[model samples]
Target: MKFAPSVGVKFHEDGSVRRFPGNTFICHVDPSLDLINELAWAQEQLKAMKCGFKFSYLPIESMHMTVFEGVCDQIRLAEKWTSNLALDVPLSETTDYFAKAVSNLGAHQGFEMVYDYVHNCQIGGSAIRIKPANEETKQALAHCREELRKATGISMPDFDDYHFHITLSYRVIELEEHEKAELKATTDRIAERISQSFGILKHRAVEFCTFDDMFEFKPMLTLA
Candidate 1:
C-alpha cells in the first residue's frame, strides 16, 4: 500500500473533488536533475512518434515531488491547525520545531535519499506512467504525508492504498485507433531503456503553493 501501480484517484469522476478557490497547497521537493533529463528524453521520444499533443509534457521547472496537497492554506490557517494538532508540545513552540526538523533532513544524514530505479506504467487512465525505483521512496514520502496529516488534520487515503508516481507529464487524451498502434510501437521502442534513476533529494525548503502561483516555490517559513 505504501506504493502501488495505481491509487484509483478517479480524476475523471465528476464529484471526486470540488474545484475550490486557488490551488491545493502542499509541501514538495523541487524536481531533481534525473527527473528533468528523463522528462526531456520522454518528450523527445513522444515527439518522434508524432504524438506530442496526446500528452502534455511538464516543463522541467514545473516538476516536483508532492509531500501533500489540499491542506489548509499556510498563510491563513497554519497557525491554528498546528496549534491544535501539536503532539505533546505547546501550540506556540511546535511549529518552529517542526520546520527545522524537516528542513535539516537531507543526504548528510541519509533520509534525503535517492530513487535509483525508475519505470513507466499507466496510471489513473493516463498513458505513459513514470515512477520511482521502488517502494522505499514511496514509504519515505508517505511518512512525510502522515506527519503532515497529523499536524494539519488534513485527510489522506491509507498509505498502502496510494499510488506513487514520479513523473510530471500526463496524457491529455485517449488513444485513437491509429494513435494506439503508434503508441504501442513507441512504447516498445522505449521499453528497453525506460527505467531510470533520479538522484538524492536535497530539499532546500518546503513550499506551500496555490495553482495561481505555480511558477514560484513560495517559502512557507522564514528561516532567519
Candidate 2:
C-alpha cells in the first residue's frame, strides 16, 4: 500500500475536485492552431508519466491562459470583489455585472505569448506556464490588465506577482518523496519538448469566462 497525505482539500483521492467559483479574463487556446497542437502534445506527455500520484486532467478545449483573475466566493474581501456589488452577490450575477462593465473598453489589441515551462502548483496541481512573446506584447497585456482593474475595482493580493498559466491537472493525492522527484523530471522534459516545438501562440482577444470548478470555463463575453 502507498503512504501519502490524505488532507484532500482541493481534490479527493477518488478524483473528484471541489468547486472553485470565479470569473476572469483568459486567452483561450482553441483559436490558435499552434497552441492547440503544443497543448495536445504536452497533455500526452503529462499523462504518460508513471508516477504513483493520481492526477485529474482537464479537457483540452477548456485549456486557457488566464490574463487577470476575477472574483471568487472563498475570498469575500472588498478588494477582491467589485465595490458596488454586495459581497454576497451570486457569482452568475457578478459575472453579468463584470461583462457589462468591461464591454465598453475599446478593442484590446491582440498579443502573442510563448511557452515558459510546466511546474507543480504549491497547493496541489500542475500548469504550463506562459509569458508574452516580446516586450511589446508584455506591455500590451499589462495595459489591458490595468484597464480591467480600473473598471472592475478588484485588485488581487498577488497582482504584482501574477503568473500566467494554463492549468493541466490537479493532484488527487500527495506524492511520496521519490514520486515527487519523478514528477519534476517528467514536467521538465515536457517543458523542453514544448519550447522546441512551438514558437508563438496568437491570442486575438481576451474572453470573460466564469467557472464553477477547475475543469470548465464558460465564456460570457469576448473583449477584443
Candidate 3:
C-alpha cells in the first residue's frame, strides 16, 4: 500500500532502546497478487465455516514478514544489515530466503535470531513453530538458511525447531469445541493442499503481508 518514512528509536552500545522509532515497517510481507488470492480464498473459507469466530480477516496492508524491530538503535543495525543484504541479493529471493532460513534454523535458533535481530530489538512479533515435514522439506529449509547466513554473515544459534504457520490470523475470539474442530478440519485441508502445491514449486517468495491491526505499520520500505 502506502510507504511512509519515519525515524525509529536510537540505540545505545548495549542494544537497548535509546528511543523508539515513530515510523517503521512494522510488518513486511510479499506484495504479490497471487498471495492476495490465496489469502482471499482462505478468508472465504474461514468466513463460511462460521465457527463463531469473531476475528476479522487480516487486510493485506497489515500482514508482513518482519525483518526486524525493537528500540531505535538495534533496528538501525538490522536496517543496515538488510540494506547491505539488498545489495548482494534480489529482493524477492532475499525475502524468500529469510523466511525459509528462519524456518529451517529450527525453533531454538529461529527464536534466537528473531530475538536477537527482530524481537530483542523491540520488534513486536511472534516466533512461529516449525511443523513436521519430510526429509525433502527439511533439506530445502536448511539450504535456504545456509545461504542466508553466508550472504549476511550472521550466524544463527543452535535452533532445531520448526513451525508451519505464516502468522496469518490472530486475536481469535473464543470458539466452542465443535467450532474449533470444524475450523481445524477446514484449515487443515487447506494447509495440506497448499503445502503440496508449494512442495512442487521449487522456488517461492515471501512478497506480501496482512495484519490484524493496520495502524501499527509505519515507515514502510519497498524493494523496487
Tell me the tens digit of each residue's lDDT in model 3 across 1-38: 11112212232232222333222222243455354455
In model 1, what lDDT does residue 85 have?
46
**TM-scores for every candidate against the unseen true structure:** 0.53, 0.88, 0.41
lDDT of 2: 0.78
Task: Between candidates 1 and 3, name the one with more favorable TM-score.
Answer: 1
Q: How many residue pairs clash in each candidate?
A: 2, 1, 36
Task: Please write out the lDDT profile of model 2 over residues 1-224, one tens digit for every residue.
Answer: 43224234444557665666788888788644866777777777777878633777878888888888898876688877887689988888888888989999877756888878886986667888888999999999889999998888778778878888888877776677787887888888878887787678777688988887767888888886
Q: How many collisions between residues are there in candidate 3?
A: 36
Which sections of candidate 3 miss by over 4 Å?
1-27, 69-165, 199-216, 220-224
**Most TM-score-accurate candidate:** 2
Q: What's the true lDDT of residue 93 in model 3?
A: 49
User: After superposing candidate 2, which stretches have Cα over 4 Å from the reference?
Assistant: 1-10
**lDDT by candidate, in order shown:** 0.44, 0.78, 0.37
As a TM-score, model 2 comes out at 0.88
